[model samples]
Target: MLGPNGAGKSSIYHSIIGLVKPTFGKIIIDGIDVTNIPTHQRCTKFGISWVPQYGGSWSDLTVYDNLVAIAELHIKSKEERLAKVNNLIRKFELQNVVNLKSKFLSGGQVRKLTLAMSMVKNTKILILDEPFAALDPQSVRMIQQIIVSLQMFEKISVSISDHSSRDLLSCVDNAMVLSEGKIVAKGTPPRSDKKY
Candidate 1:
């Protein structure tokens, strides 16, 4: 999703993830209406995962510990969970700082850890809100590449909201522009010079 700030982009994302109840219309995921489902049930029932604009994570925990915690909450079996976490850490190149406290890592490293944590459960839909906010151009490009790689390899449905139309459209297969509380425009095969 490509939208200007305060366009209710995050509101829509919250509604889809079951964080907020929709006033009307239905939220159908994997052919099921989940608008009434609870937040915790949204993940298992709808196979969705959400990472907020801030790149959700535990600031006090080490990178590995944060992943392990989320893994435990959403996955069963210590051995299986550990293996999966380890695989993603290596896949995302997080091994070098996996043991460092999240507060100690650079902005880009923290973003990577947050993304790796989101991938722990193999979700069907991954929603990221304003992922590149405050990121340098180089950092934003790196994150975009990682997201594209994940989608290609895992075949995961991704929804991303960004202030930069160029970044979001370039990375996503589809684009939707929202203004004030509604979708203003939507298209596929994003234009290189597209602007929101």
Candidate 2:
């Protein structure tokens, strides 16, 4: 989703993620009506996961610890948690900062960690809200690359909400432009490859 500030993009995210219940209509996911589902159940049962604006993380915990903590909550097997954590660390390229406190990570690394953290629950759909905000150009580009990869290679469905149409469109295969809580435009990105 591409929308300017206060265009209700985040509000839409909240509704779908169960943070804010919809006043009407069904919030369906994976062919099931999830409007009545709780926030945790939306993720645990429907395979929907999200990273909010500014990214989600435990500031005091190390990068590795953050990944491990999420895995521990969602995965029951001891061996499964270890495997999932290890895969996320390698997938996000956080090997160098594994022991570093999340508060100390660079902007790009923190974004990487948050997205990785969301996947610990076997996320089928990843929703990112304003992921491009408050980052330097380099970090922005890095995140763009990661988003494209997550959809293309990792096979995760992604919906991103950002004011920067150019940046967000570049990372997505399809897009819906929102204005004042309404969808103004919906279509594929100009490029079919969607290579950022």
Candidate 3:
């Protein structure tokens, strides 16, 4: 999704995640109606995972612990939880800060951690709202790389909504422009492909 601020981009994401209730329209995913389903059920039953704009983190928990905690929610075995957590730690390149509390992580690292956290579940569709916001150039590039990796390597469908259309142009295969809560334009996004 490509939209200016207040274009209802975040609202759409929230609605899909069941954070905001829609007045009437049905919410369908993979040809199933999930309209008005609770957020937890939508995530667990529908294979949807979301990362909010500001980065989702349990500030007091260590990087390793954060991954473990989320994994435990879905994976039953102790060994499985540890295995998944460690794998994501490696994949996300957070080995050096594994024991450090998430509150102390840099902005980019926090973003990476949240991405790892989302993968703890068998998520098929990933929703990222305002992913490129409030980051330095290098951090933006780092996040972009991870987003691409998640989509290509993990085979997860990604829906990203951001006001920074230039940054996301190359990242999205299809794009929609929203204005005043309605789609104004949509198609394959124009590629900027600027080297970061």
Candidate 4:
């Protein structure tokens, strides 16, 4: 999704995740209606997860603890939770700061942590809103790589919304443009020589 401010990109994501209900439409996942389902149930039952624009973190908790907490919500066994957390930490290169409070992590680290937390339950559909906002070039590239790997290797379906489409053109298979809460265009992203 590519849109101007207040164009309802975030609203769509919220609605899908059960954070905000739609006034006149249904939300279906895997051909099942889930519009009225609770957020936790949607997550655990449907394998949907979301990462908001501002990274989701328990500021006081250590990176390792944050991952553990998220995993515990859907995973029953302590051994399973630990296994997932450890794998994510290693994949995101977070082991060096695993014991540090999330509040002390750099912007990039927080973003990576949020992504890791969202995957704790083996989410099938991952929604990210403004994932590349407020990050340096290196962080942006790193996150883009991770997103691609998640889809290619983990088989996760990823949906993302952002103001600029530059970073996403190469990663996404389809693009939609929204204006005033309505879709203005939907198709492949413009080629390098063309404008959207």
Query: Which candidate leads the pack in TM-score?
Result: 4
User: On lDDT, who's better, 1 or 2?
Assistant: 2
Q: How accurate is candidate 3 locally (lDDT)?
A: 0.84
Q: Candidate 3's residue-wise lDDT over 44-149, tens digit each?
A: 8878889997859899999999998888888999988898999989987899999999999998788888878987888789998877776677767777777787
Tens digit of per-residue lDDT, candidate 1, span 21-131: 888999887788988888888877767888887748888899999999999987899999999899978876788998898989887787778878888886888888877
Candidate 4 global lDDT: 0.86
Assess every candidate by TM-score.
0.85, 0.84, 0.86, 0.88
**Considering TM-score, where higher is better, how would the candidates rank from best to worst?**
4, 3, 1, 2
lDDT of 4 by residue, 1-196 (tens): 9999999999999999899999998999989999989998987797888998885999999999999988888789998888889998998789899999999999888988998888787779999998888778877777788787788889999998889877876677788999999999999765662222
Ranked by lDDT, top first: 4, 2, 3, 1
In terms of lDDT, which candidate is strongest?
4
Candidate 1 to native Cα RMSD, angstroms: 3.1
Candidate 3: clashing pairs of residues: none
Give stretches of model 4 more than 4 Å off: 190-196
Count the clashes in each prediction: 0, 0, 0, 0
Cα lDDT of model 2 by residue, 25-110, tens digit? 78988788989989987777767888887748999999999998888888999998999999978876789999999999987788
Query: Stretches of candidate 2 above 4 Å error?
Result: 135-142
